[model samples]
Target: MSDLARPRRSVLYMPGAKARALEKARGLPADSLILDLEDAVGPTEKEAARELVVQTLKEGGFGLREVTVRVNGLDTEWGEADIRAIAAMGPDAIVVPKVNAPADLHAVERLMDDAGAPAATKIWAMMETPIGILNAREIAAATPRLACFVMGTNDLVKELGALHTEGRAEVMTSLGWCLLAARAHGLAILDGVYNAYQDEAGNRAACRLGREMGFDGKTLIHPAQLDIANAEFGPSEADVELAKRQVAAFEETRAKGEAVAVVDGKIVENLHVETAKKLIAQAEAIAKMQAG
Candidate 1:
């Protein structure tokens, strides 16, 4: 964790080649905009897309939302150019797809260093493949520069040969592993994009499930998914109230020199207090953003 606190409830991916979409995203509610040069760009257009991405970054008009460039796999020809352009332009972060080992992070870090990228420029990994899930912990623990993990549920589903059930039961194991790895490293982890953009009910269901599964946010393919993602990730009024109550109770006990506190007939530990404080802080931030 870079101690750079960002609310990434909704991350929307835009094709790096589409200048119009890039411009239009400035008004969207997405917390992050990913200029995608990987899956979105065609083979013939990869170089052109990289140029457009560089131009967009150089122009510098994306509002408060975080901007990330999703480069092609490091093994590909376009990947080198993508990395070079991104390093030169220097967005908030570079998202590397299909990262399976610590070596991948090392390679990227070296490239970034060679490019003389700022230390503030962070790396976010997409854990999609089988090898990636298996080695996620090692990969996450590999670098202090790693900030977050974005799940590629669609790719993982394909690799595992599993169907997307109503409740996402098939991908539960991999999802759990991703959350565990992220928590172990104290990094933010986002759920993969829900492909059914037109299906509002399906999108909300998936977003709710992701929140229940402890994801910090969900990656989105469409701008329409932004509101639902944001709403799902934000703490509810009841939740904020409960968290405040827990904190108050814990503080009252601490004032009396007591180590342990009981809240709502349940034991509240230091971990619980920390969680409550985080929730309150997030809630306040979201409220302030909404107010403005």
Candidate 2:
């Protein structure tokens, strides 16, 4: 699958300090996994978590799931060491936290380069600070290795001094800015995690909102939330059928030297055909990932 088309429908966060969690993650149905060495790890466990995460990556049993390591902020004591260690390991990407500007990414890129990280490993930024939201575009275009934005809504809410309402009214503007930047740069973006893990309805509702807001997927806090994220973000059977119809109808119209076709009483144009084809490709990619 193309890098852009790789399914990120359910990106679960697995605490790097927990060996059982890391082992369990290999069999989880998540489309992507963020092996977290930052917030999830207690301050006393930082070095241990980093070492454990490195060992887990070396073991490498995650089949087809995009694995990324979320390092602590560079300002923190463990951040530099985390980057130097993770960069050398070369997971799919190295996630940087609280990236306030392009300079943060550049700094991390330098550390990555100094560590001799492989070219295949990309960088994913956490858009959590107000300055980061304000400088979304520059961060998105910061480095060639930058490939994704992972929303850190919990930190963002705290940073904004705003409440986390059900509708996320407080953070919609911030989300929009990052989304625009990611799309503008052709990078994948994920929605923040839904905290109410036990509330299936609430989690589903949040996933629906994220999907409607054009998020490629959502960061999940628990394994239980994986199914809902996958279902809400991936193309449904009805959507796949519609895409197939739109593609076929557009081809037929083009054969007749026409510029438009109608599908289900809606006019389909070249732009719609293009979108339909992308949707079809995404669905196929998801299927292939699931099959593996």
Candidate 3:
């Protein structure tokens, strides 16, 4: 299956400066890893970290975890260098943080192209600033290579001068806007990381909330958060079974020249069947990743 259709239930962040952490990411169960060069790296170690990230991506110990390098923003001194360096190694995607407009994506795409980045290498834009939240739709549709939006909630909160409540009450409007934009443009949207890594209960609750918010997954700060994120976002066994039944019933109806089918005493339409097929495909993709 294509990476686009693969389940991205838990995307963990690993600091770019830590060689050991990068090496250890190979064993994590997270669906993807953002090799962070933005907030995670110190200014003094930016260049060194960039080198390490590039070397690490080329070294290739990261199993099925989709590797994406989160570069510093174009406005930063290290941003261009980070993109140019990471482009050479060609990680799955280059994540640009704090994207305020489509012009931001356009600038990054131009840099990636100039750096000889492969066509398959995608761009993951983070919707953080208030301007970014407002312009999400334009940004999502800005580039054909735009793959997903990684919400930078910490920055967002700082920008809005809003409190980080237990349920992210202040951030709901921003989240909802970005989610709508992503869905409208056929792009994947991942929820922001829960800051309280020590609070497992809080983390789990937050993950559940993100799942209920129609997020494909949640960005994680610690590997310890993976279990809850995966469980909450990945299709449950019961859900998979129901999806299987729906798909079978719909396929049978299609074979019989019918437009609809009844599954579990409920009417199933074409859209329902489509959802079922996606569920099954996602499950299969996750299974394949886990098997390896």
- Best candidate, lDDT: 2
lDDT by residue (188-272, candidate 2, tens digit) is: 9999999999999999999999999999999999999999999999999999999999999999999999999999999999999
Displacement of residue 142 (Cα, Å) in model 2 is 0.5
* Candidate 3 residue pairs in backbone clash: none
The lDDT for every candidate, in the order shown, is 0.88, 0.95, 0.92
lDDT, residue 284, model 3: 90
| Rank order (by lDDT, best first) | 2, 3, 1
Measured against the true structure, the TM-scores of the candidates, in listed sequence, are 0.93, 0.99, 0.97
True-structure lDDT of candidate 3 = 0.92
Pairwise TM-score winner, candidates 1 and 3: 3
Candidate 1 per-residue C-alpha lDDT over 146-259 given as tens digits, one digit per residue, 9 for 90 to 100: 999999989999999989898889889889998999999989999998998989899999999998889989999998888899989988899899899999999999999998
Lowest summed lDDT across 10 adjacent residues in model 1 is found at 1-10
lDDT of 3 by residue, 180-287 (tens): 999998888899999988898999899899989999999999988999899999998999999999989989999999999998899999999888889888899889
Q: Model 2 reaches what TM-score against the true structure?
A: 0.99
